[model samples]
Target: MRSVLVTGGAGFIGANLVLELQNRYPDAWIVVVDDFRSGHFSNLEGFRGDCIASNVAELRLSERFRDGTFDAIFHLASITDTTDHDQLRQVRDNVESFRMLLNWASRDQTPVVYASSAATYGKAQSVMTEATDASPQNVYAFSKVQLDNLARYYHQQHPAWKIVGLRYFNVYGPREAHKGHASSMIFQLFQQMAAGKRPRIFTDGEQRRDFVYVKDVVAATLAALMAPDSRIYNIGSGASASFNQIVAGLNKALGTQLEPDYFENPYPFYQNFTEADISLARKELEYQPAFDLDRGIHDYVDWLQKERSS
Candidate 1:
């Protein structure tokens, strides 16, 4: 059986990716690692695989480091919560864990396909291409940029190691229950509307994002894993939508005419009027996002309703 290790397999994207892999590669031996610090056990419900609830950095110190060999490693574990963590903590947890994984992967010569963030392209005037115009706005983005730099360094230093860093846009979908403050606007809107409340949107609801669905993100990740090349790719729909558009979509899906409560933008945030140039991924990985914003929002809202009812 093909063996793979997903570092944050119990979190939002990780859990969805695990389910997708299980369906696609039935005989694959999937090992999931999550600390449950922010990840939830409920996300792994009905999953049929080996699961280890532990920190990735701690796992690097164990005997499994020598015994296990994986066809590919998906490093998704990180301090993704922008508000809950400070810069130093984000670096320590994210950069340090990634460093340990890279060190081990380099020694084992194992292929790594990891999650990078669109936040790395913070406040870029134009679309974020493959170039190194990384204006990271926050700790989370800074950590991801650090990983991308590390991947580039490793690829240059050790030509044998295959590493692909996927710069993921705003990802949203089912099984993302623990996302809390970091959850997508769609999910948050669903929850608010369900409770008969209008969802609050920030910054006059004008800030835009390249909101890629979780399934598409997983497909891109899998493609990166199977691809032979070692390069950074932007995984997004290449289309942009404002917060107003998202709220409108959700209202349509839920059959309600609720308006969003507008608020001032919080934090020293990157008001990202951003879209991905997914040309490289299209040319190389044959990756194209299948879901549009309205369709994705409808599907997510339906799932959220069912999940909440259950």
Candidate 2:
């Protein structure tokens, strides 16, 4: 059976991807490796797989590294906190963990498909293309950029390795539990609204993001795993919508006329008029995003409401 190792398999995106893979590739063995620092066991509640709860960097040095040779490795483990102030920790967890995974993949000659971030395109003034001129605004973006550089370096040195990096846009969906600070805006808004509280949105509701659903991301990721060449692709809806649009969708779904309370921007966060150029993914991987912003938000809100009641 084809075995695959998914680092950070308990995270929002990682957990969703693991479940999707389990359904799609039932005969294949899925090994989940996570540190559970930012991730949680609750995220893998229904997962039935060989899961090793450990730091991915430490796992690289373990006997499993030598004994088990995976057909593919999905390196999703990283310090995903964009607001984290610890630069050193971000580097240690995101960059160092990725380096260790790359080293192991290089040794085993396994294909690697890893998660990069749209944050790498910090304060994008122009259109974001697959260029190396990354202006990372935060430690998280910097760490991802560092990992992408490492992957490029390794690819140059060892052309035989298949390494693909995906720059994910704003991802949100079901199965993302209310993990307090780590939860998505959609989940947080739904929780607050369900509790008869007004959902607070940052900025004047004009701030935009290319909100891509988790299932679409999973499909793109799976496509990347099978692709022959190594390349980076932007996984998003290729469309941008204002925060007002999001709130409107939620209000429509919930049948509530709740006005969103807007707050001032805290930090000088990257408020780009963000939209993805997913032509590369469409052409290369035949990826078509199944959910638009309205549909995705409606689905999320409905799921959240049902989940909370249940």
Candidate 3:
């Protein structure tokens, strides 16, 4: 059986990717490592694997991975709360864990595919390309930026091994309810409407994002695993959608007419607009996002309603 290690395998995106990998590689032996700091074990319900309950920071390379060789390492473990005020903890938990991964990769020469964030771009201009200057507005984003830079440095030092970084934009889909405040606007709006309440949004709900679905993100990441070259690729729908659009999409999908309660956004730093220049991802990873905002929200709400009913 093919062996693969998925860090953060109990989290939102990681759980989805694990299911996909199981479907793609039916006989593969998957090792899931999750500390459950943010991820929920319910996310891994019915999953069949040897799950190691440990943090990447506290892992021993000789003892943990000495017996087996993995085809790829999906490094999704990190402190992703963008509103976190603790910068030192962000570095200690996120950057330090990534350093451990880099150390293992350096010795094992395994392909390391990590989850980078479009948060690295901050409130900069939209339609950002890979070459665009990164202006991280939060500690979490800064941590990701540090990891991306470190990935590049590792790639340079170990050119023979493939280390891919995917800069994901605003993503939403199934299995994200555990994220709570960190969940996507699409999910949050559906919750409000499902509860027969108005959706709460920031300002006029005009803040836009390149809301790519989870399916697309996983597909793109899978493609990147087979990519001939290693580098950072922007994983997002090359289009932007306003929060108002998400509200509308949810209402339409849920068969309810609900208006959004727009309040003043109090955050000092907010990303008002984000649209990825996905030309690089398309050319390199052969990745094309399958879901736009309207369709993605519709599908998500449909599944969510069924889940709730079941």
lDDT of 2 by residue, 1-310 (tens): 3788899998888998898888888888899998888788878877888889888777745467567788888889888778896988888888888888887678766899999988888887655677736888888899999988998899998988889999998888976673466566677777777777888988688888788998899999999976668888888889888888888887887888888998887878664566778989998899999999888888787777677688
Error of 3 at 201 (Å): 0.7
Error of 1 at 243 (Å): 0.7
The pairs that clash in candidate 3 are: none
Q: Candidate 2: RMSD over Cα atoms?
A: 1.6
- Candidate RMSDs in order: 1.5, 1.6, 1.0
Runs off by more than 4 Å, candidate 2: none
lDDT of each: 0.85, 0.83, 0.88
State which candidate, 1 or 3, has the greater TM-score.
3
Residue 225 of candidate 2: its Cα lDDT? 70
Of the two candidates 2 and 3, the one with more favorable lDDT, higher being better, is 3
TM-score of 3: 0.98
Whole-model alpha-carbon lDDT for candidate 2: 0.83
* Top candidate by lDDT: 3
Q: Give the per-residue lDDT digits (tens) of candidate 3, residues 111-200.
A: 989999999999877589988899988889899999998998888888898999999999899898988988887888788889999999
Tell me the tens digit of each residue's lDDT in model 1 across 78-169. Answer: 98886755878888889888888888888777899899988888887678798848988887888888999889888998987889999998
Off by over 4 Å in 3: none
